[model samples]
Target chain A: MTQLQGAAPLGATVVAEHGPTDPRDQRPVRGRKKVGIGKVIAWIVMVIILVITIFPFYWMLRTALSSNGALYGNSTSLLPADFSWGGFERVFGLQTVDEAIAQGGSGAKLDFWRYLLNSVVVATCVTVFQVFFSAMAAYAFSRLRWRGRNAVFGLFLLSLMVPVIFTLLPNFLLVRQLGLIDTLLGIMLPSLFMAPFAIFFLRQFFLNVPHEVEEAALVDGASKVRVFFSLIVPMSAAPIATISILTYITSWNDYFWPLMVSYTDDSRVLTVALGAFRAQSPQGGPDWAGLMAATLIAALPMIVLFALFAKRIVNSIGFTGLK
Target chain B: MAITSPGVAHSAPNGRTSVDARRRRPDDTKLALLFILPAVIGLVVFYFWPLARGIWLSFTSWDLLSPSQLIGFANYQRMFADPVFWNAVQVTLWYVVLNIGIQTIVALVIAVLMQRLTQSTFVRSLILAPFLVSNVVAALVFFWILDFQLGIGNQMLEWIGLDRIGFFTSEEWAIPTIALVNVWRHMGYTALLIFAGLQAIPANLYEAARVDGASETRMFTGITLPLLRPILGLVLIISVIGSFQVFDTVSVTTGGGPVNASRVLQVYIYENAFAQFDFGYASALSVAMLAILVVVTFFQYRITRAGQTDLN
Candidate 1:
């Protein structure tokens, strides 16, 4: 029944049932060999749906690898047309202005390397600090018995309902007044310390932790802070790691707030950079090859991360979605 | 002791009364305050303060250059009179309806299929791949694929001897195109959420029904649908609230264009706030959006009874 709530326990059960699970194992269910016509039809439909879901990603790669001039003539080709690394070269500013223009690029340097660095910095700072601070608050809310704890936590939870757009204007103004506008600091400030979701997620985990361990630590003269650091933090590492990954992805993918805060390549993240790149369509139309290359590059980090931590990320989605 | 130790007897072991255990601890209030101070400070300064200031800024007129002057519902009055605002509201609602409707149905089918058939992690990961990328990437990829002249989508249509459709360029197709793009991005994630709920349904129920000679369709309608209501309700509310704030995709693809056909509320508010520098009016619009979401959420909660579960 623990499977009813979270993916973690489900994953654990799977691991126990099948030793050292392989993600590629596509074995059908045991004792379910009665493949009716209906089942075959279902499998066909599922495959078709899967193809539809995955085809665009393939198309993006195909277009990115193709030359811009060749894309117009071979629009429907399955493979890359006039295959070249020119699109990626243009995105990385490896091509000279004339070379870029010759390849149908805007010839305007994208500063993609700078934006990528900016994204790394902003996402890392926001994820590390937000998760840490939220965990501390979660510990207070869940483990400690204190006056006004539930009320304060409830107030934090209520803020979740306040759509982020409602606060955008004021927060933008505040960031500006703090002289953080057009800086990485501005992009990171609003989300730097805590998120209600992070707190709620951690608090739920903390609530289930038996108090006896903490009580034992206290009896041995450890402070509450020490107990939290030494006991709770290590014990709840899984939830903490889960929250960190989620926060990192969110921060990396964030467009709106960063779009408002970041104006130049110095602080502009990949998402905003991609948006700006698309908006500035030179002569004939957008540099399709270059644009696709940049989009793919921008999405690469997250894709790689998802690939590495697919199980953990997938499991956490169940927990987050239900919340 | 009686009042303080209502239900916490387990912690007081080894001849320690609950009151004695409590007395051994340092001041919890001070420790809690210390623990929560950083998050609380951030929440107040960034979230709570901004929320209040946004509400206040709504009632005043500020153009960034001058001091905000009290305008007393002038922004709200202007919004009510503004056709563009109404058009934005309409476009947003239409987009939400399309997004939620299509996303929900597709996700449900996908979820049911995954539950009944194989449980391949590879398949689940593939379904969730689109969601991992940012909206900008999804929009750009789709925009290129769905371009009017040179797009592969149009090329395929022409191959079928059908007239090419202007996906983002035509008003008729802009909202739907944007909606569909987002649907592609979100449906898999939503399906996973529903799939989790489906996992919770007991196999005994199915076996019991099978023994009673119930058909698959009959069991699905009778057991699966009823059991999945709480999850479905929660997913719907989450999806609807998210769909209403559709900004990134539309902003990237159409910029609310082909003539205001996809000018979602967020886009309109952003334009007023940043482009026009009409912060006051933008604040009012945001307040309006917030009110709508709150009311909608309340109604959805009441209608879905999302808080209640049939499992127990």
Candidate 2:
């Protein structure tokens, strides 16, 4: 137990599973701590890399804040010289490019708010349905005894290798044939059910739950359905949440399918909108400040979600790998 | 994903299944099917059926408007003969090669450094920040930052009195630029994987090597790298698979580029299917992609299986 305590301080379940277990894991030398050149070098390297990783977002924010004149000005200032909210206003439709230009401001005419709402709706539905359906299937694969179970599971594993592109064109045809084209439902229905990777990841997590716990519930006259809802769901919240976040991110970031199906602003998501918005700019190129503002607004939810769940997201990736 | 026997066999300990448990097996099977029905229906409709139909679509001349005509192997022949297809294949392979090389080295180095730190959530989160952003956003950010005219990248070059390079407008520089953005977006996830592998290595091995007066570089080469083989293999396979399907980045930024320099396989397939309304040809291209992936995945599984050790 002490060894487990010393294994990892936070996000320990994933690390604990992968952590060295044998006594040979312990070092002969211990209990010495001081600053060293190696430590300094590591910090320096980390700091430098961190800056590089973060600078792009900082630049996005900085550009989003600048006025159009300031952005295309002769001098490229290191700071936001002409900071304003006009770009974001154009994005939200509180102001339009014509209105801004008429008043000597720069803006773009985009259905940013509509796209944001569509992204949220699609991502949320995909997350909820994908998690529920995956959990149901994972439960069967991990705990229940059944005929042809291994065969069906094998099909799932095999399909994992089939690059989504192959299914994509045919599936698009399927959706179009069903007369579901140009609708958000067409964009959402294909992937909203369950994914092979989600099922596999969840199944691995479910397999780790000991048999005794479920047996105990069964002995108390609990049906399999009862046991699943009463015991499995409660015990597997961590992994379920992890799967939910992953699904939401993937669905929100999804561009190709949405781009294929959605043509009008009524159904277009942020990613597709961003692309259309870019192409709609005047001859000189996109309005850099307004474009940056739209980009930030599109990315803000994910960045915030990532910030909040950084540890779990990392651990989920580790857990998926270890399996 | 392999269905091992342990979970089932372990439940009945001592090789003894009571008569009651044996009798209950049928009920378990029934309940299992019930629980699995929703997903199974989805898989048949969306996954397996589409895969089989995609193959059939590949043989037919199904443009979006007209009915499909049965013309077996014609799509393949046309694809093989087409210069654009060949260019796409060349572009995709080169992108995969360069992407894997850059991502593996950068990720491994970052992982090694991260493993040395005691408390690294903040730093790790910063590294992971880009990974969370949608690829479109990442491309857009890079699109502006690497803009030939007002780009910070070129601005910095001007500050240093160096020639401003054409990032997306030039044939030679475009693909590599896109590949670099791909690396920047994904390196953190791979680093975390390798970092996890590092943590699982027993410390006594390092201590023993130190007792023998081994240099740090020797210890790294002799122990760390070898122990990291499995995780590194996983990273390599994943990077290769992902790089091959490069679409969003290319579409949003280059749109297959300044002279089709970055016309990756996915973008190429997409254009054929949607833009040109050549569903059969698009399906053929997708099949080609699947074949390449299958071969690559087979070799990866074989190599990893052969070099298998008790990773944990």
Candidate 3:
């Protein structure tokens, strides 16, 4: 475990070691005269790649802001021409003109709010349970010396390669047998049990915690559980945050598992709800504006999370040896 | 970050090794068991039991409404004869190859470029942004953008005097198109992994090579490729495993349609179990997938290890 943790930070350490001499640090000032045709080509390729990557989000936002007429009509404006909040309002369950017309007399009885709430509730439960259990297991695997520790840890690691789909059916049956079908608990249960990946990642982080800190706590007569709660977890905040973010993102974005178990608005997450909404469109094609709006709503939390913790998240991903 | 330096942490072990200190404590075994119990129970109930049950289920016929009867090797025999299953296998393999092949190359190129750039944070975040978007939303975005009539993809193609392609509707293009979209969504993540690998290469080695008059191309091929072997293996393993399990995007975009062009194994399993309600056949398919995965991973390990030795 110690060796693994040591291996993990080699990249970070080398990057740090070479910081002062890195060509990147001096490139801006001295690179102008040195820019060859090759350099120019590289930059152009990079920028084009960047544009391709970022353009979809831009297009989604533009479609979200545009009226349904602009998307379907002959105008074909690339940008938002006439701004409209109809899509957003409809998603938020405020009866829009489209909804009123679509339902003929009464407004569309969309359960967007309920779906969003279910997503939130499920994602939160999965994140909390997965992280908490993973931390305990990781601490035990890394810090505690026991008879069967290596064997247990090895089994967990081996299970990491098991494709989740392999277990989906039988797990579904198990959940159904437990009478958890169509409940948020049913949707969340499969993932709420922390997987091998989380344990492995957290174990790497826990191994990095200095032995002396825990030794001191132990020497001072603090119990193992108390020491773990008070000292180990607090010191391992970066990885804890990383796991929390990852777990939350995964739980939030999960579609198939939730779709399998959840049937109604009471348990259906935003992704499944959006999928049903898009599929149930009357004719022609899906409501582009409404779909885009819902996509944005589903995507915004993750975007905001990336904006807030891009560095931390990226570093954790890079340094922890998780893909 | 501060704790990562094991060298520093190792030197000052308070003059008492952890094992020696641990010997004084007798309650540690019980405490450890307590700590690991939840995870252990979770794995048993959620993973191991289900895994065993899935294997057991493959021999039985269960349709949610009726009692399951064990008919040994029946599901596997049917699977071997099923043309749809064969088609699914072919489609899945194609998707995995294209997805991994495209993503690996693109991510490697981007990672190398990212290493040279100064404003990498902005670029990295922008590139990784799509990965955060759920598969459902990603499929929707690409669905609209790749729409035959209203899609911007076809619009741009027409502007360039090429025919508008049916991304999800046509059999020839559907699988490849979905693979491309999957690549686009995940390449950034793969790039970051490769970037970390690039960073870990000691700068002094490149400096020494440059001083010895090695060309940039030679340096990259000789030094970078060999050194990057391990992380590349990791990336390939992750990509292959992930792509093989493709379901969400396929379900949303093609519904395995236009003639089963995009029906990968997961989609096949989903349809059999949920739609057709044939739990036995689905379980058989699931077992086959698991077997294939294990074999593929073993080969991946062997090949990457072989590459490491050849490079050395």
DockQ, per model, reads 0.42, 0.47, 0.45
Ranking by lDDT: 1, 2, 3
Maximum-lDDT candidate: 1
- Candidate maximizing DockQ: 2
Better of 1 and 2 by TM-score: 1
Candidate 2 share of real interface contacts: 0.51
lDDT of 2 by residue, A1-323 (tens): 12222322222222335311232342323233667787799779877877889999998999888776667773267787488887777777787567766433345556688999999999999889888988999999987888999999988777776777788888898899999887889999988778888887778667777777877677677888887898988898887888888889989999988999887987899999988877766555567777899899989999989988887776655545422
Cα TM-score of candidate 2? 0.92
Q: Report the lDDT tens digits of candidate 3 across residue range B1-312.
A: 211222122334445677646575565789899889889988888888899999999999989898999999999999999999999999999999898999999999998888765445667788788988898889889988898887788889999999989989999999999999998899888887788668766565666677788887988887788778776876687678788899889998889998888889899999999999999999999999999998998899788752241222
User: Judged by DockQ cut-offs, is candidate 2 incorrect, acceptable, medium or high?
Assistant: acceptable
Computed on alpha carbons, the lDDT of every model, listed in order, comes to: 0.84, 0.79, 0.78
Q: What tens digits encode model 1's per-residue C-alpha lDDT throughout A37-59?
A: 97889899899989988998889
Model 2 chain B is weakest, by summed lDDT over 10 consecutive residues, at B1-10
User: Best by TM-score, which number?
Assistant: 1
lDDT of 1: 0.84
- i-RMSD of all predictions: 7.8, 6.3, 6.4
